[model samples]
Target: MRSSLLRVGVVAGASALVLATMPASLVSASPVTDPPAVDCQSVLAAPTLDAAFDAAAEAADVPSDLLRAVSYMQSRWEGHDGRVSNDGGYGMFNLKSTTTAVPDGAGKGSTDRSPRRTASQLERAAELTGIPASTVRSDDRANVCAAAALTASYAPDLNASTQPQRWTAAIARFGSADTFERQVLTTLREGRARTTSGGETVTLDGDPTVDVAPPSASDPETDCPPDLGCEWIPAGYEKLVPSDPDSTGNYGNHDKADRTGPGGPKLKYIVIHDTETAYDPTIGLVTDPGYLAWNYTIRSSDGHIANHLDPKDVGWHAGNWYVNAHSIGIEHEGWAGSAGWFTEAMYEQSAKLVRHLAHEHDIPLDRAHIIGHDQVPGVTSGATRNVHWDPGPYWDWEHYFDLVQAPIGQSAKNTSSVKAGDVVEVRGGYADNVNTITGCQQASPGSGDCVPGQGTNFVLAYQSPSLEAPLANDPGWKPNGAAGTTYASDISARIQSGHKLVVAEVRDEWLGVWWAGSLVWVHNPATRPVVLRTTAKTVTTTSTTAAPIFGRAYPEPEAYAPYEIPVQSIAPLEYTLGAGQTYAVSDDDVVTDYYYAQSFDGSIPDDRTDVKGELRYYQLWYAHKQVFVKADDVTLLDPGKRAVVPTRLPKITGEAKVGSALTVSNGRWSREVTDFRYTWLVGGRPVAGATGYTFTPRPADAGERVVAVVSVDDPALHPMLAPSLPTAKIQR
Candidate 1:
């Protein structure tokens, strides 16, 4: 944690007297009051959390009652330990500070704004207690002790008082927020009972009539931006159910889900979106039960906000339910093509709201965690080609990130310099960016204005540094190797701001990146900053030819259902990275699975469920689009050295029957690679152009048996090959 105010004063005798009279929620070393089920001696002698708090309070000369009350208000007795809260707080006391470690959670690839500092309360606690930050993060007792010490240090003027009301101001001072004191006093007076993470019972008795005189602030509601017009318009779910017995539920807006459990899918992302409609209509659509629901909606006119759902529940706004389940979707009033629809007031207010929510949820303040709706991935391989692109090219990501206090260019020293294997980030200035688009139309039919607008979240990639050069090729969009276009919907060639990609080649003022399995160039201006550089690990192939790229990351074959027809082939892409080309790997070992929920209507069985697979793939920074490759395909290596080689081999899949397609799977291994290649062998002889994920037995092989030769490679290692055992003889 950064340096904080060390404002401890000389401890007066009144402090000790006040501390001696207060009743602690946990068992203490002293026998001043009736202890709970646990005895004071046993608690202090053992390494229980209660003893740590008691000792810390004693050492700091703080009242244990006050310490317990403050902690309860912050985390409700649940210590997240190493895992941080949405607001960046950690452990039982919700300590927050900054360090350079990347946040641990889902979508690791999307959060490549690495080499940035992060602060947590846990670090602050470590600083005060003189305990190692690692120990404080892992040990519950140490965490509690540190929190107690910090709280004690904050209230040097507090004296021993039996009544809780007297310590209200000091308690408030401990949290450093306007609402902290009232909330703590409220919990202290009313009392609280909770089962700690350790399964121990702790309780604080309530005092209904206790008067808590706290120093009030002018703006008491601290969670919201004071300048915005925010309202609470509830959206009812009961009306969504059908009246007729045979009819399915009409609810399509949100899910009445259970609380996210400890091992349950974690809440990792906060999606930003645009309504593409008027503010009132968007609100009406959100509240209409038949339409989808997002957590909050910000109007463009006055920056007015309407919160429709609880953050804990799932919203149906993002096309992907897996993301919807693990995210808080916030919609802004605007059209994708029109710059006038996104107002400065709305942007400021949204940033404030986002900052507040990110803090409250302990979400990391980075582009990966704070993503636009356009960034959300499709559930299946086929769906990737079509997803919402609203809050599009005009969202002003650079300015928004600055408002969130995690600007991209501030983290690294040589942010402007680029080199081969360096991770290049598109940091195109939102306001100053002047790329021309051929087509600009209003998102809504009646929204008006088809004229091209001025705003940007992307930079056009070209074949060369000059503007006359053709746009980069997108294999997924144009497989024949056609040049990319300036079409508004043509996201294939443009690099959106905040996305990190590996540099494949670099010239004087132009740098090439691996995009959609081909080298794409970003024109670097000498005067104005268009790209930033950072360090990242990448996966490359040792093959002499281009390597394949995939759309989805799926688990190995044995892990998936045998009868399940491959929804969309996880085959190697036709467009491949040139041999020796290195690209950033988003995540080397990404789980392969599909979220297969189609509707909220109960009449349709298995409507809201996930079809999971055990397969794994490596997510790569190959293109503006999210792409993946099988874990067995390439080697995982750092910038300077090669990683250890895998000892595992590949296995053949699918029935060996004639006319049936067979595939190969990478067997279990410690580490994962990408760009898997395959070859079909007929009686140990190679077949031409049979290099896809699947292969069919040819008619000419009347008696010859079939087998599959699977090859995997990366820049660090030579290609690793495994041939499946020969199948039963082919029957003519």
Candidate 2:
């Protein structure tokens, strides 16, 4: 194993605290706190969160406002009924066990560092106040008091007379990373107002007098934004087996390959994942040669990033090798299940990183290109069951995308009704999106027994357009044909906030969408809208029979034969697209090719060769994972190619005279062009040989008014005719 993340703080002299091992839930960006098991949102009636902070501050002789600000920065002062975080943290203070944070002889991704372990804030607070650890976990007042004691311990000589500015070092010592300290200081300067889970508004008027320096520039070695606090904690890339080409077995971590140069695979997606383990443990595992590696990991406590692999290299984080070869993987310091809430710092840093990556690689910042680990498709049929689900129900996709400058439903229509064949985007609030999910304990042991209506980003789809109907379960989720359950890991019937789907039906309060080769309904009450109509390009199957979908977009077998490389099969997945049913497509120009990276050191013949093929595939948002279909299998709907009618009628320009030319213009035609056949009429009757723009009137037509009749032929549309006003009588 490699080194853990936490170590004694050199900046915090004589404190000997492990700043990297700080509690994230203690400093969560969102509201934290688990109400008692019965109700997840209930607040304690007695000794309210505010009163506890006040009492704790007085008891520890720390500045009351400073303590409150610290608590506000850690968690929005909410406590889930004492649920433990992934790192075994509990209550509002995010208290945890410091003894188990660091393993002996651990390094910090480099050999220059020494082994160190510092007692956690909860442990130190327990020693100072003589309060039992169990009491601190359950008792909000005690937890607050313990946290205050630890903060005061950092500055022993300080008293009520000390200013908040003087306590900056003390706050710095309490948390690991300069980024976490800056976030706390930012909160102190600007203040904050949040409605707590207990139905009360807490306001911190904030003191502008408090000076807060901007975050330090990101380390030069890491591939991160300058404003972010980044570190270069590289994941292990050593070979465990000699002559083990193809990386089939016995090797740990990622693969090395170029991704940005000419003829190299283009970067397409950025897969988001959550570390099931805590921050320190995540470091240990990623640095271990026996463990899998990703590109980066964001710390929830402060959004401090650890770049594990280069963006151009391949990481084995996503389950599908095809996705792994073409995308960058980022693991968050959180969990797959409902272990705890994510931090604002984590979301902010992750967004900055993603935006930076997207801009650098020319990847779209939409949800389709920026997907979760759950959205990664399996490499083959019957393989999706083992795929992972992280950044689970609690992750706020709507907000995360907003931070990425690509807000969900930003361009959707808020109509009162929708119909079949309409395309829509699923949109909803995140904080109030409390979806009921059972069996949380089964998903992550000790996380909880039930989520009890926590914030979930997705809406469940049903078998029929009715609330009483069963959920729409996919063939991969239920091969035996059972309906999907409201389990934390079960995303079979779920469609997330930004997923664009084709509407198949509309009941009184339900909207049906074509999901996984079937029509499924999701509730869309007017009071709480879940669907926003959008103008998205959709794909329809042309074949009479169902067209098979594929998990990977590999090239034809003949493409590999030219280079003497082994052929990769273009196998079809179980899902298919039937005629007349349309699915939303993400990309129409998906590359149909494969990269043969056969050896760890490029020793094998024809290794590291990228084979491009003539075949093409279109990527579609089919079911849970994005699947591919042959471009020949479905017709891509192009708005530009559709038949269009002119909004304004055609008109004749210039005065009509016996010898003058009268030109007619196709005015205001949109979406299609107009070609007209013109004829000159005399007294409502056609004049022989007068089809030309300029016609010479003879003496026989001097008293008659002439009219120009235009017959228009729009491309792919029926013909129409318009007549010009009667022209001045031909001059004698």
- The deviation in Å at residue 548 for candidate 1 is 6.1
What TM-score does model 2 achieve against the real structure? 0.74
Q: Model 2, 547-604: lDDT tens per residue?
A: 8888888988888877868889888876777654678888887977787775666666
**Which ranges in model 1 have alpha carbons more than 4 Å from their true place?**
1-230, 234-241, 244-250, 378-385, 411-416, 442-455, 479-481, 541-579, 587-614, 639-732
Model 1 earns a TM-score of 0.52
Tens-digit lDDT string for candidate 1 (351-379): 87888878877776766568877766655
* Model 1 superposed RMSD (Cα): 22.5
Task: Give the least accurate 10-residue stretch of model 2, judged by summed lDDT.
Answer: 1-10
Report lDDT per candidate.
0.57, 0.69
Quote the positional error of residue 164 for candidate 1 in Å: 38
